[model samples]
Target: MVDYQIKIENCNSIDCADILIKKGSLNIKYGPNGLGKSTIARAIVSQARNDGSLELLAPFKGRGKAGAGQPKVSGIDGIASALVFDEGYVNQFAFQQDEVVKNSFDIFIKTAEYEKTMLEIEALFAGIKKAFSDNVEIEQTTKDLKELRDAFGKTNADGSIAKSSKLLKAYGSGNKIENIPEVLKPFESFIKSQDPSKWIGWQIKGNEFLKLGDTCPYCSTALPDGPQKDIPLAVAKEYDANAIAHLNTLKAVIERLGKYFSPKGQENLEKITKAKLELTAPEKSFLSGLKTDIEALIAMLEGLRTISFYSLRDVDEIADKIRLLKIDLGMTEKLDSVETRKVTEPINAQLEELIKQVGALKGSINKHKAKIKKAIEENQDSINSFLKSAGYKYSVVIIPEPDSYKMKLLHKDLAGHIDSASKHLSYGEKNAFALVLFMHQVLSDNPDIIVLDDPISSFDKNKKFAILHELFRGKASLRDRTTLMLTHDIEPAIDVIKSKASAFQGASPSATFLSSKGGIVTEVQIKPDEIHTFAKICTEILSAPGDTLIKSIYLRRYFEIMDNVGLAYNLLASLFKKRANPTVQSATESRDMTGSEKSQAVAEIKKHIAEFDYDALVNTVSDDNAMKAKFFATEVGYEKIQLFRIIRGKHEDDVISKFINESYHIENEYVMQLNPHKFEGVPEYVVDECSRLLKTA
Candidate 1:
């Protein structure tokens, strides 16, 4: 439980020595209005906040300093202050009263402007930087891969072993060469066997052809007339035949070498063969071009590989830079896998949740925005309920946007709507709204304590009372931990104090009231009268059969007794009267009143007394002796009636002696044990005499 107390000095009517409040779980101060009650509440709040002693008042201490006069006391360092104030106090301390009834949405807009600006900038930077980093990584990877692929073409096409077979053809058969090594070797041998020096040589000048006629060295043919077609044809045929035979032999040799060579040797031989075939192209133009192309491709591949190394280094550097940036931004602590795991795991989780929230909120905002007009027309009741609770009953719309939220309050009925929050409500209401919004914010964060200034100033008396009552009733729920309410309302304070009497019935709480008189602070104990008044009010309000008439009568009698005898005497007298009086009467009629006229007279007398006509006590009792006899018999029974008769109108001592002699007859069956304490120390006659005096008086 929390222990709340207040002390004041040197402010308003209070000054000098500090008044120590009693250590009650609850304490209340009651006084007439304008006695600086609110002032004390404010002072206590200020002191609790500044001096850091508010922990004594409520849930627990927070981060802040305490005000003056609330010093750090022993054994109470964890106490925090929770003060809820009335509308007037709220207005004076929190916000202007005139703004209370203004639209909550507008107020939120005006206040959230700066906060929105900062958050938006932060979110934007975060989003942009993350996107840029991700894009850079992707782009760098793509560029490096493209460079690698470009350096390595689809296939080797520079007359290498792979391309030679694709270009070769069979000699004289007009068929593609199936065995490239055999064909190439045979053709080389044929070229060597057909020596150009053995044949006649000729030259062509201009359009005329000059040829030596012989061509006879290989075929032994004479030259023909004109172009000598026959002689050249014969020599070409014989030479082709010889070339074919030599090519066949060369093919056999190459095949044998291929079979005999080791795998490594064969690979080298294939490379040499490809190079040789590339050199056999017409004019050697294609071969030379292919060689250049292959060389270029090789050089380009080397350059690309080198560039790939630099690119990898650059990627690593960029990644390192990002890691450092993360640490600088407090996003991560290190580039190690463990650190990455520690940092990214939570962030990823949070990011997922944020995405979910953003999605939901976006959808909701869109839906709500779309139905704004329809909601205003069809869901006015729902809107009104929310508005009333939020302290806005006029024209207002709460619109939640995608990136930001908005609230609009309009006075459409007026000539022009007020766009700003400068209309309607008083200062107290504004403070109350601010307090409500603050509470909402705190609830969103789920804090343990709710510290507030006066939050009820702008309300009317009924509202003030209602709010206080609700707060007190909700003590179990609303005050799960502790609540410190500072107020100047004496009535409510008194109510709380009186309630404490029963609330803490088995264990009473401590209570203290401090008042300033003649510049000195004095602690005034709540008087019994004040306590009774509170008790009376509570009993009337909370007790069963809560009747105003009964309460009024009780109060009237209570005050009357207070002015005369003490309340104790009044209580005792009332108890005696209730116990002594007969609550019910017999309905049976007496046998002596048989005649109609006699019965009627007796009945009339009975009726008047039964009706509580006290005058009838004297009127009906015309004979004093008979009335006394009857009164004595009814009081002490029939046996005591005889004693009363003997004591009537006689000297009290003599009458008492005669009654004792007869009443205490030892032989009398009716007489049982006598009280030794009543008659032992005194003579029998004295005891009897004292009894007779009690009867007569």
Candidate 2:
């Protein structure tokens, strides 16, 4: 397997990081929230997409003009594609409006094998597909149908045109100038020209000039005082420019395409244009019927031209439709354009070819269908079982779509399929489902790298394990692939590496702890033996080589975690408090422990400490000045926090108080805590703040 030492520079909190990832295995990088894990995920995906989005990950302080401090990633040579399961993926692709996951078919069923079969079937019908796309007659006929249909103006349900319809507005109040009024006969030549709309516009513009001066606007001649001055009124009576333009457009369309019209339809069109008043209801009905007929012809042509194995119906039914397609060419030349055979001849040839080879085509298609059906069934069962196993009320059903399949989200407790998955499901539920779907996607896609950026940190313990198993150990999981799971939660490591180690053996999962200091990030590989319970980690720390005060702190926590609040625990607590030992709190007063009790506590403490001395440990811990010096001199972040806690035990300080309130006490007994030295769970800022307080003091 290939090993990657990925280097990232100038990306968010990380100024430079050389992270090692093992190929062909699941790598879990566990760190705190602010260690720039998400930034690493983004940098990897940005480089994979190669879409110039990597520039967005530049550090805010260094984000300026081009090349100022552009984020860079290297050493990921072989990884060309990656799928990231982060909040963005969940919000955008998962829990879509109509399906559980957007493009569910492509993710779940459109396998490379499926595509191979489809390409073979498409190759068999390539001639017809090419004919549909390249035929000039078919192309022109489609354009003609669209042009004719558009002239009718948007029709209503009752076949009556909308009031805003151009046809209705142009012809509802008939303004035909068939017989110009006697008063307007002087300009009859202008109205009778083939391009009368242009002249009507010119006359209308000149009429506006009548309001300005009343001289002939076109000729600049003196106005006649007689009936010639009434010419503007006569022009207005005979023309409306906008209506005339629409009417001219309709007349031109009918003149060019009227040869395809029925004889009765052509006569109706002539009567409608010659009508001196509004068109009769019969004329509108005729236009509506003619529009429907044109749309039907377009549909028939589209069906014939675009035939494929997918669009195949019964052979005879399609043949009859092709044979019955007819158009009236009454009183026109017997042109091939008017005969339906002109469109159907080649299509019929392709159809006959299809009929000859249809058995093989159907067999190939049925094989693919059966394979796809099984995949859908298996995909549905896998997702539904995960939902049920994880105690989710929602289930998924994969339904076949025209081109592919879609997974519908169904809630067992609710009524129908969830229309809005994001709205109906909780944040955890959405993430859970999206993650399972993403696992299948990763398996189907088999990208070079699969990045799950903090995928399961939001889930509780049970759901977290449930999702983890589904993602890495379940059937058709992301096993034996180079996957990076960047998360801030350590429970995943504790579960996958320690508790559920045997279960995830097939996944070949490895884990590491990420820690960032200043601007440089580093990692420590966590072996299965390294992750353990808090009590066990504390015991291990007590036995390892370290400062006595640090060991005492671990011992104190161990006792507390174990509920062993004996004399040794109280004595250590008081020593950290800088109070006299052998003192215990009774009902309301502080009482000294009896000599016998002190002796027994010392014996128990010596069992672990071996060379234990209460006064020596107390003196070491109680010296604030000495502890403050140790805190600065120490390089380890966790050791520094322990030293800071000791130095400010009796002192009232905000930094010390925050550590006490947030992390010091036994808030939860069952919660697993990582070894701070190994995991570096302490934030760098917290250490900085503690050092700041120490320096001021």
Candidate 3:
């Protein structure tokens, strides 16, 4: 069937879409990337593998209810198989040439780019395959961490972490000093009315005054060396012994609390920081905040110590400060503590998963690279033949090195021994290699349909022309087969239309463009390029208001192909003369004829169009006259053509009208001017007339 309609729903970038390919062979669909071009290509291949498996038809990525999201491919009949060549197919067969790493930074940048893609792939997998829920868990954990960090506190206005002070006394009272209690007892009565808290403070002041000797507040000693000779030697040992005993007791309590405040308590935070894990913004800030608090708490504990003599107030202050610190340090699980293993254990588990998944992604890519090398080795001869035919000079030869697997591109030398293809081939050359691989396995094997997406990526103009010629010219040109090609490059597409201009001399090239509007793939009408048959030419000529020159050229050429140029010309010229003015063919004629010209005019027209008296070419027994008569002929040569007319009747006015209009418009335009560069080229009247003629023919 020349016409095939495929309905694509939720397929990759396409939402719910339908594209009608009128004449399927050598069709080229044009669109931008992410516009469902590749989606449609893969869908065709998937359907070929299993028409009934809707799972294959499912879009590679999209959002919807699971099964409901599966794309539906309908109305494909006799499309036995559609093989596809795309970036994905290329990656399966080719590799970059080994090169020296002159710059380490470049490798780092590429690795980062690769990592990003790997993450994206994992996320996609998480969505498609339920078993790959690792990313899902990471995402959820990250989200939870975000909420927690926001609840903790707003960050300092700057992005940098607020540096916590190392000074222990930055908070609470740390003014009390270790001193002898007996030295202060002598002054106890001097401040007897003072409360115990006040008395302890006054007594400490009294001892400092005594250390001054004559100038000290109590003894009023002026000499600095005077107090050294009379220092209380006997009592010092007793105080020293008491201080050591008290130190042991307090140290034990301090040790008990250190487990919760020390770096040991912040194991998860340390691990996350050391891993330099690339978590979300909130997660990073949250961990940083926790680490800062741990450091501040450790600094506070450094100031706590016991003395030989302890005042009641100092002891209470120490106890009260420690309790408050425990709170600040997140030691109490009021709701949930940040440093607690329970809070961070799941996150740590998720972090481990990130590592595993990232590695898995890298492994998967490497595995594909290796597999391509193996596939090339296995299919060398066939692939090389396909390449040479497609205009490449090289043959693929895999050189097995124990250290690494690599493929060498080889070409024949004068002496007949194959040598390396070249020092380096451009990116386009490698892409050509990929196309050759595809052509060998798919197009050369006679698949009913071949869908190539962006087939000439990175291709220069010369390469583009070579590819179009290699694929579309001579016997290699797709004939009696439906080839669907899509590209984002408009220039190449225009060239392709121009290159195939001759083979479809009297027939329209089955080329159309697809545009995505609101995620739907809609066919944009291609004019003049598709106008290719006898009826189309007559309609366009009859309908034109200004210029019918191109259509006239088309009419002559089409009749020539049917071997009826002179005979059909004679009849049409007479009909127009008999009616005076040519009218658009219709059930109700567009207008009544007014006699305009005669046979002299028809003969003059023949002189303008005859191009060496084509009538001479049409005078054989079953000549142009007989062929022209066969349009109304009931027998053999015309049955298939007549059936197309009957099928035209079965469709709605819109479909039939579109088909013929494009056919006539494209064919006529190509004949006169290969480039359809301007608007107002063909009038509306011609459009309707062409539809009318095709319907009748």
Q: TM-score of model 3 relative to the true fold? A: 0.32
For each candidate in turn, the TM-score is: 0.30, 0.84, 0.32
**Candidate 2, residues 508-544: lDDT per residue as tens digits?**
8888988888989999989877766788988887887
Q: In model 1, where do residues sit more than 4 Å from their true spots?
A: 2-28, 32-48, 51-76, 79-128, 133-397, 401-403, 406-422, 426-461, 469-478, 494-513, 518-697
lDDT, candidate 1, 1-697, per-residue tens: 4443334544544444343332323344433233445555555554544665433433122225454443222222243443443554334433322222233333333234334543443352343234334443323333432332232233355533222221221122221122223323333333344442122122111112214544443344564565444433433433333333433443344344343233443454344333423334342333233334334433432332222111222232332322222212122111113422342344334334434344343443344434443433333333333335444545444554433334444444565333435346455544544444343333233333333333444465555544444333322123332333333333344344454334333223233344433445444555333443422442343333422222222332333333423322222222222322212112342222124533343343333222322223323233446444544443222223233333343434565446444432223211112112111212223334444554566
Cα displacement (angstroms), candidate 1, residue 79, comes to 4.4
Candidate number achieving the greatest TM-score relative to the actual structure: 2
Clashes of each: 31, 0, 17
The CA lDDT at 349 in model 3 is 45
Task: Give the per-residue lDDT of model 3 (tens digit) for 154-234.
Answer: 345664333232111111111112222454444345323323334344434455545444564545555356445333332
**Arrange candidates by lDDT, highest first: which order?**
2, 3, 1
Q: Highest lDDT, which number?
A: 2
User: What's the C-alpha lDDT at position 364 in model 1?
Assistant: 38
How high is the CA lDDT of each candidate model?
A: 0.36, 0.76, 0.45
| Over 4 Å off, model 2 | 9-12, 46-72, 123-134, 150-185, 188-231, 234-242, 262-289, 309-340, 400-405, 544-546, 586-597, 632-636, 650-661, 668-674, 677-679
Q: Would you list the rank order by TM-score, best first?
A: 2, 3, 1
Q: Could you give the C-alpha RMSD of every candidate to the true structure, in order shown?
A: 35.5, 4.5, 22.6
What global local distance difference test value does model 2 have? 0.76
